[model samples]
Target: MFLIFPVLSYGNNITLDEMLNMIDIKNFDKKIYDLEIEKNLSKEKFYNLDSYNGVKGEADIKYDYDKDKYDTNGKLTYGDFYVNISKNKISNDIDNGDSEIICGINKNLKNIIYSKSDSELKKLDYLKMKDKFYYLDKLESKKIDLINLYEEYKNNEFETKLKSNNLSKLKTEEKILKKSYELGAIPKIDLQTLQVSRENLEIELKILDKNLKKIKDRFLYEFNIDISNKTLADIQVKQIDISKYIPNIGERYLQSLDLDRKITIENINYLSYSNKVPDISLGIERKKETHNNTNSENRIFLKVSKDLFYYDVNLENEKINLAQQNINYRKENEKNISNQLKIQENYNNFYRNYIINKNKANLESNKYEIMKKKYTLGNITYVEVMDVFEDYLKFEVEAEKAKNLFNGYIYEIMVRGEKNHE
Candidate 1:
């Protein structure tokens, strides 16, 4: 039951976390998703600016040598506001200059409302990306769990091979015992006992071989690794408090749903205000002239304009209805996540029991070693020793399976809608 084999090392051996990181780095789809998120972030920033309606400014300087006059003027405008400043100078008999400045403000109700809605939509898009990134993280974590399962399967496979070799040796010994009995070198009962032992070993070996094949097929299908000649390092198992680590799936679902609702609402707003409102602008101007006598003039200006044919009341109402439908859909999705969380909680309990079983199996294996020492001292018959050996092997196999199950559950809990990895 406690067979020893030479240790093998390979440079390809990697931890579960390291394997996940490698997969992420090499994944083309993940890279594409990240690039899309970056593009959305840039759009969000563009919309978040205060002057999304496009702003411009201009300055002009003029010189007239024949008239011996100079003029400087500057104007700044954004959305519905404009400011103007002007200075004029005369250089003849009188070196005189005049300056004036004016500022005004107004609004384009349609563009302002549209820009606000657009910014909100961009913000919602950014929030949705949070869930997308989280989903990719969970996928990577699941891959790690699968790789760890493969490693455990390989460990069981190695043990099965050892058992098969031992069984073969026992069968050879049984054949020799039969020959000795025929030659009158050993008793018939001794040969019979050896035959019985060989039969039991054959049955156990067959079961082990079947189990090994099942694991091998699964490993190859999932990871495409033949593992026949591969040596996997032992995976470490640790005890953890499951309740403390269970993911809050309901919370995560709600957050994603909130983003969806916000996006829908923003779309409704954009539909309701698109080209329906009027564009207005206010301006102020002042001019000063210094020719024979200084003179200044101030003016206040206002403009209001509206699109003649861009109204869609029915479309706006339809969009609002669609937003309501989206909210309802999100609520239903959240309910589904709640149910999934319950299922995951049950799985956690099952894995906890697996860990307990693993500990019990380990204890049984240690006891079997003591029994083996007693048998070496000739206190027990060979058949009795083999029976204890069979029991110990059974427990060892159970322990290996339990360890893999527990590790898988730990990874599932750590990555399922979790904000932080453990």
Candidate 2:
């Protein structure tokens, strides 16, 4: 995943992306999800092994001292193949002893039927891990958005401080204007205008203070971080094309369908094997005995066993129906995600335009200094100068909000596994 982090200078000179990445490393949910993926990978490896069911081996030994007889048997099995060996010996009263040996091979063909389904299920588990990782990535993106919002709140604080300072300066101007009016050096109308401007500034400052407190409280509630002393880095808007990064929702939907299909197929196989097929073992056996006369026999045998009442047709049909329902649900979910992606893309575009407009406004607001110079040169009225100041302040505050919204859109695009472009 390519993430664009525009650089900005702030206290300690840390970029927002870097800070978010660092915070993600310490996220408890991310750690837990990592562990879960590791655990699932371990399980996948275990299930892929041929001996996952278990290695089978058996040995037996017998001795009868009164008849001086000895017997031994051993067997080993792995997957569908098995080997067996047995030996026996007998001694008679004439002090003569005879020994015989037997060996044979056996194979089980039924066990291989389940291996394919088991492998598919393990693969599905790995896919689920990918989903979990994606989810965690989105969560981290959301936290980055919170950081951006906090930055906006800090901008609000900055604006509030500027307003407070302006209010102080206006108060001093109001006192001087009042003295001038009383001394008949200035018009009473000018003093009334200053008084009204001061009152409006005070009201606006109070509103800003209330909003700033609310923003701080929300930031604390969401991120558990006190931003009272924190310095937020500035944001720079960059153009990027993310269309190529958008994955096909249909393909993801197909993956989900594939999982359901594989599970259904496995279950069908299981049901068919259980209901219509009998467990069978094929082997060659050899036996030998030593007694009054030596005797030996070799035979090949096949054994079959069946459970007549084991079939559950209704249960099998129910499982098949459930699998179909899962496939349908996945298809609908894919459509929903596709729609959501479109909506998010639209939102990003809106923010991109918003940033552009705000930048333009900021450029226009720069003319406020020119207006101030005109006022000093007696080219513009005092009220005109104050109007310019108000416009500049309004634009400045709105530009901060626009940056916040734009950054939020960027984060949303990232969470959706898409690129945010201007």
Tell me the whole-model lDDT of each prediction, alpha carbons only. 0.63, 0.64
Per-residue alpha-carbon lDDT of model 1 for 285-400, expressed as tens digits? 56555555767787776778876877677667767767676867667776766766775666766677777777877777787677657755757555565667667667767666
CA error at residue 85 for candidate 1, angstroms: 30
Clashing pairs in 1: none
Each model's TM-score?
A: 0.55, 0.60
C-alpha RMSD (angstroms) for model 1: 11.1
Per-model RMSD to reference: 11.1, 8.2
* C-alpha lDDT (0 to 100) for residue 194 of candidate 2: 67
* Candidate 2 lDDT over residue span 37-120, tens digit each: 787766666667755367688998899998788777777776555556666667554544455556566654555565444645
| Model 1: residue 343 alpha-carbon error in angstroms | 5.4
